[model samples]
Target: MTLMHKILGTAAAFALSAGAALSEPAMIYDLGGKFDKSFNEAAFAGAEKWKAETGETYREIELQSEAQREQALRRFAEAGLNPIVMAGFAFGSILEEVAADYPDTKFAIIDMVVDAPNVRSIVFSEHEGSYLAGMMAAMASKTGTVGFIGGMDIPLIRKFACGYVQGVKAANPDATVIQNMTGTTPTAWNDPVKGGELTRAQISQGADVIYAAAGGTGVGVLQTAADEGILSIGVDSNQNYMHPGQVLTSMVKRVDVAVYDAFMSGADLETGIFTLGLAQDGVGYAVDDNNAALVNDDMIAAVEDAKAKIISGEIVVHDYMTDNTCPVK
Candidate 1:
């Protein structure tokens, strides 16, 4: 074998490897979207992990308008990418139509379910995780009242509120839950100004501790908590860093882990609605480098006890439409 022939073969192999890596699909992030450091960041972490370990390339389309949702998904499909990942509950219906049309391509959506042979729906037992957060807030609250703020009026967001209400009540039956929505539209998650306003309103209503599940809007809630000198709970991702010292603890939803796992296991994007909750490290409390000092050992121990009880089947968190037969409106 001549030296020239050996070099040519090596170059060809390298090109083929590069081509394969570039063929992977992209991800579409919902509005109030990427770098939220709460929700979208979790999905972004998954894409990053894919790039680092699997050598796959993924792009993200930040949704600004409703039309962007359809356009972004279609653009990725037309570009010949496979398994486009979509984040957020807002894309539920969009995933249904796109996945059906692009039978050759695969689609993965988080937080909602759509039935398509080519799609995988990744959901979370958010209620279960929120329930745990509720317990933490109740135990940690000095004011005996905590507030719940949701990003939207959708049933999905309600799940978070319901779990929180139950968890707090279980911990301190006298605990009052003041719930508010950022908005009724998809823009609800993105409006931090409104989120803060609502947070302030809840504070006025006697809520000493507030939990913001309103995506980017939650940032406002965190800011309010910090500015007002009160306690706040974060949602979707570890938000303890949002306000550093003021954020009591975050309801850690392992969205990053979910995104990474899906990327690693591609063939089964269909027939899978991977729900991450307390048991799978999919959701829990966040306390490491950021706000560990803010939470006492007893709080951690109690949360751990609740976790074990949950895992051991002693506690079953309620889904508003399901287990919560007589849900409080």
Candidate 2:
């Protein structure tokens, strides 16, 4: 979609906004939205950045129901915003159609690849971050088994699970990795009830640490951990405060970076792909309030080393949807 450009000398540019700025930094979120604290919340953080950077007011349209996804995209595009951004891979189809329909409005979708001239699709190599988390899970587990709870059984979530399992195997050959999904649909991302139940099930099956990439559902998983006296890892955002000392670590996606950079890149260049990975400082593990004491500095150092390898093209993290695992690399 072609983004609407303001008058060359008009309005507050991102680089120069002596006025009150755009006054409307808008974001369109996929199903889980704000409270999810995983996908949508990260985008909200970006909105916060936009507010901080331009002094422009930002608006967010959250999709509470799956059916509303397309509608939300259309409404945001019709709102005549500069760049209408969408979060989550599940919104790929909706974003494509919406961008096509609103050619004058530039569109950016996170976690998905859309090959449109006017759309800047930003994707993160989540596997690399997940691998480090997987390694940590293995090292911290006393049961020799770690659990993975995903929001949905989609290919994107699967990519996270696959990378995690492989990392655990590479770190501790003897450890077993358990995987479970919150549900089959998008609402699964917000259903904490299912998330808590799944975490308990994994624990019952001898899981020592649970890694959750289940959006809002992850909150429930952490709640289970705190109540059950087990360990849990968070995704997307730094959720260490959710469970304090019990919530081990979090794989930070830096969605805030992606959103702000995309806006700047879109303003600077017309079209291209922006792949934010470890090298770009787009993804990493968080060392915050809860995890400072539990995580070893050496482990963080090891992740940095792995990050360097990936950045230099030495360690290749494969995505299940794009790469085949048949030959077992």
Candidate 3:
């Protein structure tokens, strides 16, 4: 080939490479709404952090219905989004179905696993964080009883409940835990009215501390707890500030970190199951000014010691999703 022709060929290849690099990352939020102040919000925070740091925008979609999952995934892939990040387990089947159609596209999913060469499944050790939160709830329960409000009656939600119950039992074996599920559908995650009613029922059963793993529904749980003058726990994000002194603490799962890392990794992001546990700083209980006075030195110390043991493999929080049974309840 002539020298000029060779130079032109190389220039064309460079242009194609540059175009691929410029393709923005994308995210599809779960059904509870992007600003649900829980799971979806955490993912949003991560995407915003990436935008702020890199000054690059990303495509985003908030799923309003279950039917939208497959459509959203296909649209993003067809548009050539380098890496599409999803925020919930509900997207698992859809991701798997759509992933096969776009073999070259990289996909990242949080809280669920999609077995595909091009998909990155990010699951967190929520049981570990829930255990810590349970410890605090048990310690702070003046009534010798605590409560757990789950969004859906799924195994993942049960895992959260099981972990919390174990922590509560570890701290106070005699402590009573009252558990309730909002519903068995996606709407369960966003129904604050139902959550408030459930909180009232738990309080009637002598619960003084409540931990909510119900996404947006948790907002109602926190509000009712605050209004009723009881301690409550948050989840997914650091939501202690939601009710300040009324909130005891939050079981923080670093979904934000997972999303941020996926975005930063870009086209070269790793594919496969990425599990985040105490060892990876993927999950923990939050302590901030919102509830600083509520978390005593002893409480903090005990949780820290437990955290260390968990990291060292001395403690294993039971994941209910594994066998669908909780040792504590």
Residue 165 of model 3, lDDT score: 98
Model 3, runs deviating above 4 Å: 1-15, 18-20
Q: For candidate 2, give the lDDT.
A: 0.77
Best by TM-score: 3
Among residues 3 or more apart in sequence or in different chains, the pairs in candidate 3 whose N, CA or C atoms overlap within 3 Å are: none
Q: Estimate each model's TM-score.
A: 0.84, 0.85, 0.92
Q: Residue by residue across 1-329, what tens digits does model 1's lDDT show?
A: 65455345435643686634234557888786688767888889878978898775666688888889989998777665656888888888877888778776678888887888887877788888888889888888877889999987878778889988988988899878888988887778778899889888988888888888888788888998799988899887777876777888888787788777667765445466667778888888788667877888888888888889898889877787575442543
lDDT of each: 0.79, 0.77, 0.91
Candidate 3, residues 129-244, lDDT tens digits: the string is: 99999999999999999999999888888999999999999999999999999998788999999999999999999999999999989999999999999999999999898898
Report clash pairs, candidate 1.
none
Q: Model 1, 314: alpha-carbon shift in Å?
A: 2.0
Q: List the residue pairs that clash in candidate 2.
A: 2-104, 3-106
lDDT of 2 by residue, 51-167 (tens): 787665555777778888887777655554556677778788777777778776677778888888878878888888888888888888899999999988888788888888877
lDDT of 3: 0.91
Ranking 1 against 2 by lDDT, winner: 1
Strongest candidate by lDDT: 3
